[model samples]
Target: MKRTLVIGDIHGGLKALIQVLERAKVTTDDTLIFLGDYIDGWSESAQTIQYLIELSEKQECIFIKGNHDVWCEDYLRIGKANRTWLFHGGALTFEGYQQLSDEEKKKHLNFFERMKLYYVDDNNNLFIHAGYTSMKGPEQEFYKSNYNWDRTLWEMVLTMDKRVKKHSVLYPKRLKIYNEIYIGHTPTLYYNIETPMNAINVWNIDTGAAFTGKLTVLDVNTKQYWQSDNVNELYPNEKGRN
Candidate 1:
């Protein structure tokens, strides 16, 4: 049977991405849903995007837009972003991007342009780069900006006591809207978790690949996951935004 694999924030860790794919034993028939943040941090942002472009050509892939990705896109189109983007990891992305040819830049920019803020699969599973609030489905159009930046939804999931029967009262009906929700952006490392974590109906797959953790890819149907070696190990000589 064909499988759907959801990937976490890559953050330009191209080596980590390759390792995770190898560990997952990905097949061309498998569907890959990337939770975005494909650039920033590591030194391989340009190569990472190019690889994803090639992967899409032969494999089923869905790319979701992440906040870092939005920053990169904005910088490419208008040459501007907030200081957070510039100081955090955007400078590294810019350096990597500068190494690309003009044609490569155009192609990568187009890929960013085509990315979605969120996606809902036939199984009613929501795949988003970040969280979503407004208690509405993806089609409801509550706040377009929040589609790639919201953290409240995932935060709510983290704080609610899943062991309690009354946990439903803590969140909106939207919390129950999907059979499962997979997201990246807020790294699991912030919660002291170094792997994919399940909270309520949400799965956080960002294992802080941009920082001290590894890249992660999870099979949506089986809940089986694969992880890369520590991202820092892949780029031993680089500071990687630290």
Candidate 2:
């Protein structure tokens, strides 16, 4: 059966990304929706982007832009690295790109340039790298950065009162618009949960591959998921945004 799989943040851990893909037995029949942050932490930041570029040739894939991706794209375009971004894993990503030729770098930059802020499916399923703030929908969002930086949507749902009904005015209008919302910027490991998390209709897939956490992939409809081993363990010699 064909399946739509939503993947968590990669943070440049290509090994873990490969592991979860294999663990989930992914095939061309599967549609992979990566929740971005494809680069920044691990040693394979550049290689991971190249891999994704190649992978798209074999299957249906949608790439959502994450905050880290923004940083990478900016560096590629302007040739100036942001100090704040470098402190948070951008250093390794930049170092990784040093190995690529000018032409390869240009190709990779094009790849980043094409990333989407958000994607909505025929079933009204929302897929975004981070959270959006607009109540109407991502399309009507006033602040475009919120698509790749907002955390309030996740936090609100995380703390939402369980007693509130979906139809109640007390319930969030944001949550009412979609059948389900999937995001990745906020890692589940931040809360000490090393797996995918679901709060109300929102699914948080980022398992923190940037730190000591695993990479994750979930079947959007069934909620059945697969995860990789701790990413730090895969590249012990490198400190991955820890």
Candidate 3:
């Protein structure tokens, strides 16, 4: 059995992320799959992206595109547009970029553009930056739609039941695709539940890392979970609002 480490959203909390990786004892032999949101939120967005890119070159690392990443790509690709980029934690991400040189910034932006939206292993486990709603069809379609989708569409998909909704056409019946779908986004608290879902074979690992949540990781084969101590207490003012 291949040992894979699935990581949750890392919203620029470089210190916290480093601790989690160290705790996981990541080795050259193991695969590290990041679910995205590598930038924005804390103070190390640029650094985090650089580190991940470096790691990718050294080992097998899968990078997925988070909503924030999409915004970053847009902001860099287009001269200007929606301020939503700045409003939705882009300010922090921009701040992180300030710490880097012009050349470094260009390099990171190039990397962000090349990230994949989702990763599906032969074993059946699906990895996506965020959970999908019923509106999309087929895994590939979901990936394409999500890359350019707006929040309203995403919300609609999340609110409706995948089985009965027209959008659910894209997703294979839960049992047919794989036993579990590992996803990020839609903070766990939005579900107002403790202990993230493992039922329907869906495991949400986001853990609200940007707010009063801890960054998380789980071993695919063993299902062993690990988390960083809640760093929210240290940044009380930035919780939820960020």
Candidate 2 per-residue lDDT over residues 89-194, each given as its tens digit:
9999989888889899899889999999899998999999888888898888999999999999999999988899899999899889999999999988789999
Query: Candidates' TM-scores?
Result: 0.94, 0.98, 0.81
Which lDDT values do the candidates have, in the order given? Answer: 0.88, 0.93, 0.70
How do all the candidates rank in terms of TM-score, highest first?
2, 1, 3
**Model 1 regions lying over 4 Å from their true place:** 79-82, 163-171
lDDT of 2 at 83: 98
Ranking by lDDT: 2, 1, 3
Clashes of each: 0, 0, 6
Model 3: per-residue lDDT, tens digit, 1-242?
A: 45799988888877778777788887778898888887677766778888888888888988888888888777666535348877877887776666777677678779988888777887877787765543332353544655324233335435545566323655444334554677777667567642344534567777777776778878988988777766465455554235
Task: Evaluate model 1: give its TM-score.
Answer: 0.94
Whole-model lDDT, model 1: 0.88
Give me the candidate number with maximum lDDT.
Answer: 2
Highest TM-score scorer: 2
lDDT of 1 by residue, 107-172 (tens): 888999999889999999999988877666766757887778888888888788767553457556
